[model samples]
Each structure stands twice: as C-alpha cells, then as structure tokens.
Target: MANGVMIFMALYPLRYLKTKVDRLGKADLVYLLTTSVISIAVTAAVVVTLQNGITTYLLAGVASLAVWMSTAWWVGRSRTDAPGTRER
Candidate 1:
C-alpha cells in the first residue's frame, strides 16, 4: 500500500509537470501536491481496510504498474498533441 502510494506520488509529479509546464504557477503546484497527498491517503486507507495478503499484494503490484504505464501514455499523448508542443 505504501509502495503503491509512493509509485503514484512519483508518477503524478511527472504528469503534473508535463501538463502544467507552460502555465507553471503556484496554484498548479498546490493542486498537484494536494492531489498527490490525497491519492496516497486514499490508497493507504483502502489497503488498511482490505488487509491485502501476498496474492493480493502481487495483483496490486501488477495493477499499479498498469496504471502507471497508462498514465504515462496519456500524458505523452497529451503533450504531443498540445498546440506548439514538440514531440521529443
């Protein structure tokens, strides 16, 4: 659960930074931080409530990786599609 939250925290920054680079304001930073913290808290709560075991843990790991990859792809697509944004 903690690991999942950490993964989300790390990936979220990348997406937030990419999406908000041009705007790059304090409000954006605050929003990103708030969302990240909330996501972590929610993930921890769910994990605690469910009390996941080894098999569930492995499944969670796979799900986390899938989410991370999908988010990365979405971010990449949005970045590339933005007006005046170059694909790198």
Candidate 2:
C-alpha cells in the first residue's frame, strides 16, 4: 500500500517533467528519492506484519507494480484525451 502510494505520488511530477522538459532534471531526482524512502518505510512495516517471509515481499512487490501500472495507464489515457495534449 505504501509503495503504491509512493509511486503514485511520484508519477505525476515525473510525467509532468517528461512533457515539459523532455528530460528528467533535478526535481525528478528528488521525487524519486522521496518515493524510495517512503516505499522502504512502508515495506518495512508490512514485513513486520507478515509471517510468510520472502513470499510476502514478493506478493507485495507484484501488487505494487500492478497498482503503479494501472495508475500510469489511467493518467496517460486521460492526458492524451485532454484538449491540446500531445500523444506519446
């Protein structure tokens, strides 16, 4: 859950930078770092609550990736359909 939230939070500014600057700059790095820290904290909390060892971590990773991809797809579709937005 925390990993998903961190990635979701990071995605907006990263996408914005990609569109406006054509490259990731310093702000993007900061966003990534922040996301990493948040994700680590969340993952730690989850690990403490689970008893299945590596399987729990694997499941969490898979779920987080799914959430990230779904959110990215939704955001990409919305942006493309908006007036004056360019298709990628």
Candidate 3:
C-alpha cells in the first residue's frame, strides 16, 4: 500500500512537470529530483518503522529525515543569496 501510494506520487509529478519542463532551470531540476527521492524514502522508512516497530528502519528514517530537511534549507539559502553579498 505504501509503495503504491509513493509510486503514484512520484509519477504524478511527471505529469505536472510535462508543461513546465522548459521553465525549470538546472538548479530547479536538481532540487526537485533530489527532494523527491529523499521525501519518498524518508516517508516510507518512517511509516514502515512505525508500523513494524523496527529500530533499523527507525535509524534509516532519522538519517534520511535529516538529509531531506537539510537539502531544503540549503536550496532555499542558495536561492536567497545575492551575487555581491557575503555572509561572515
């Protein structure tokens, strides 16, 4: 069931991106691809861990969750940084 749901969500994005292909820059493309994989993996891992009481899956979920959030933050930070601005 989880696999089916995740698969549908993954494929649905392709349909949505069909008309937006030309509008998305390379960075946007990379961010989207990275986030999609991380989101799916993390979501499934957390769900499975909860449903099965498995510590192994819990570790996987925590690790991926950190990665998912950090990626989002990094992308957002990059987008907001100006050409001449330097954070000290």
Q: Best candidate per TM-score, number? A: 3
lDDT by residue (1-88, candidate 3, tens digit) is 4456567645644554434332222234456567668777777767766666556455655665576557655554465342333567
Local distance difference test, per candidate? 0.52, 0.50, 0.56
Q: Distance (Å) between predicted and true CA of 41, model 2?
A: 9.6
Worst 10 residues of 1 by lDDT: 21-30
Who is ahead in TM-score, 2 or 3? 3
Candidate 2 worst ten-residue window by lDDT: 20-29
User: Model 1 RMSD to the real structure?
Assistant: 7.5
Q: In candidate 1, which residue ranges exceed 4 Å CA deviation? A: 1-11, 14-27, 54-88
- List model 1 lDDT by residue over 1-88, tens digit each: 6575577675666555545544323224445555455545554554566676765555544554555445444444455454456768
Per-residue error for 24 in candidate 3, Å, reads 11
Q: Which of the two candidates, 1 or 2, achieves a greater TM-score against the reference?
A: 1
**TM-score for each of the candidates:** 0.41, 0.40, 0.45
lDDT comparing candidate 3 with the true structure: 0.56
1-88 per-residue lDDT for model 2 (tens digits): 5456555554644554444322222223344445444545555556667858678777666654555444444444445443446768
- Per TM-score, what order, best first? 3, 1, 2
Worst 10 residues of 3 by lDDT: 18-27
Best by lDDT: 3
